[model samples]
Target chain A: AQSVTQLDSQVPVFEEAPVELRCNYSSSVSVYLFWYVQYPNQGLQLLLKYLSGSTLVKGINGFEAEFNKSQTSFHLRKPSVHISDTAEYFCAVSEEDYKLSFGAGTTVTVRA
Target chain B: DAGVTQSPTHLIKTRGQHVTLRCSPISGHKSVSWYQQVLGQGPQFIFQYYEKEERGRGNFPDRFSARQFPNYSSELNVNALLLGDSALYLCASSLNRGNYGYTFGSGTRLTVV
Candidate 1:
């Protein structure tokens, strides 16, 4: 079984400022990592994923995440944030079974 | 190109009442999974069905059950609901077991009074 841990529960940032959401997971075997963004009362939208090959994976928007194998982390980062970037972010992990385990979620609030 | 669809976007039920949630997967997708998200929390896995068979289950109670139809649609039934059951029920669909960042539905908001 794999598990994800998102350190920050809430993050507030100014518009156009850079921000990073930290995530760590515990898995003994190979795992797949993903970041999803959810607006209020909406479904989750994929931000990016790390299956293999590239440690630095880019997704929609200006968001990106780096999968650190040794540290077992997949932290999401954005060079610049917009008001639209404010949303709840979740980091998930899955083993070979493809069953996803999600973190508690971090709420990002961007102010103008 | 319809994404996963879940019916009854909002529902209200009293404790001990039974509720059923429905979901329709994306076209050509054959796997469906159910998750429960409490307020201020991440989504918790409940059940996964593939090809009309049960594939995986989480730490939910026996009162929670689900079934998948031949068309890949699925239903989640919860018996003798509790107030703690009040949460957003999410449905996700994928083409297969491998990771494809399964498409998710808007989810059904179930409020158990």
Candidate 2:
């Protein structure tokens, strides 16, 4: 079985400031990690995913995440944020292949 | 592409009633998965179907069921609805039942009153 833990429930940052959302997971086998962002009343949008080969994965909207196997972590980061970046972020893990276990999402509120 | 599409964006049902949610996967995608997202929480997996067959299931009660069609569209049916079942139900489609990116639909928000 696999489970994900998001360190923070909510993170607030001013526009143009960098931000990081922490995520950790526990699994007995290899895992695939993903970061998804959900706008209010909207579906999830894939921010980035770490399948294999690369530990540092870059995604759309200038988002990136690094998978640390030793630390059992995959933290999402952005150099700078915009007001439109305010959304709920989710971290998920797939242990065998398909079934995904998600964390309690982190709500990112970008202020002006 | 049309991305994943789920029907009846919102629904209201009474306790002990049943509800059926619909989803149309992206064209050419053969895998569909169901997830339930409660308020202030992330989505939890319920079921995964691939090639019209059950591939995986999450830690959900037998009251939760799903099926995939030849066209790869799917439906999620929940019986004996409870107030705890009130949440956003999400449908996701992938090319295969693998560790790949999945396109999700604007979930159906179910309210059990």
Candidate 3:
């Protein structure tokens, strides 16, 4: 079974500032990593995923994440954040079964 | 195209009662999964179904059950509900078992009193 751990539960940042959300995982075998965003009272939307090849993966909304194999980490980063970036972000992992194991999630609050 | 859709955006139930939630996967999606999210927490996996068969189940109790239909739609049923069962129930769909990212529904908010 694979598991994910998100370091922070909440992060507050000023608009236009850079932000990074930390995530780590433990897996017994090769796995797929994913990031999802959820707006208040809304469904989760895929932000990005790291399947294979390309440790640096770019996502929608100008967000990106780097897959560190040795560190077992996939931290999300954005050069500049906007108020619209405020949402709950989840880090997840899945093995060949594709049964996703999710982290507790980190809430990003971008304030003007 | 429409994303995954869940029915009954909100529901209130009494303890020991039974409740059912519904979900319709995106067109051409053959895999459906269910998840439960508690307040201030990330979603937890509950079940995964593909081709009307059970593929996986989470750590939830036997009281929690689900099934998929021929059309790939699914229903989640919880029996003898407890207060702890109150949470947002999410449905997700993927084209195949190996699909990477899933399309999720807005979720049904179930409150057990």
TM-score of 3: 0.98
Give the TM-score of chain A, superposed on the true chain A, for all candidates in the order listed. 0.98, 0.98, 0.99
Clashing residue pairs, candidate 1?
none
Query: RMSD, model 2, all Cα superposed?
Result: 0.8
Tens digits of per-residue lDDT, candidate 2, B1-113, equal 78899989998999999999999999999999999999999999999999999998888999999999888999999999999999999999999885787889999999999
The regions of model 1 sitting more than 4 angstroms off are: none
C-alpha lDDT score of every prediction, in listed order: 0.94, 0.94, 0.95
Judged by whole-model lDDT over C-alpha atoms, candidate 2 comes out at: 0.94
**Which RMSD values do the candidates have, in order?**
0.7, 0.8, 0.7
Off by over 4 Å in 2: none
Runs of candidate 3 with Cα error greater than 4 angstroms are none
Tens digits of lDDT, candidate 3, B20-95: 9999999999999999999998899999999999999999999999999999999999999999999999999999
**What DockQ does each listed candidate score?**
0.83, 0.85, 0.83
Chain B TM-score, candidates in order: 0.98, 0.97, 0.98
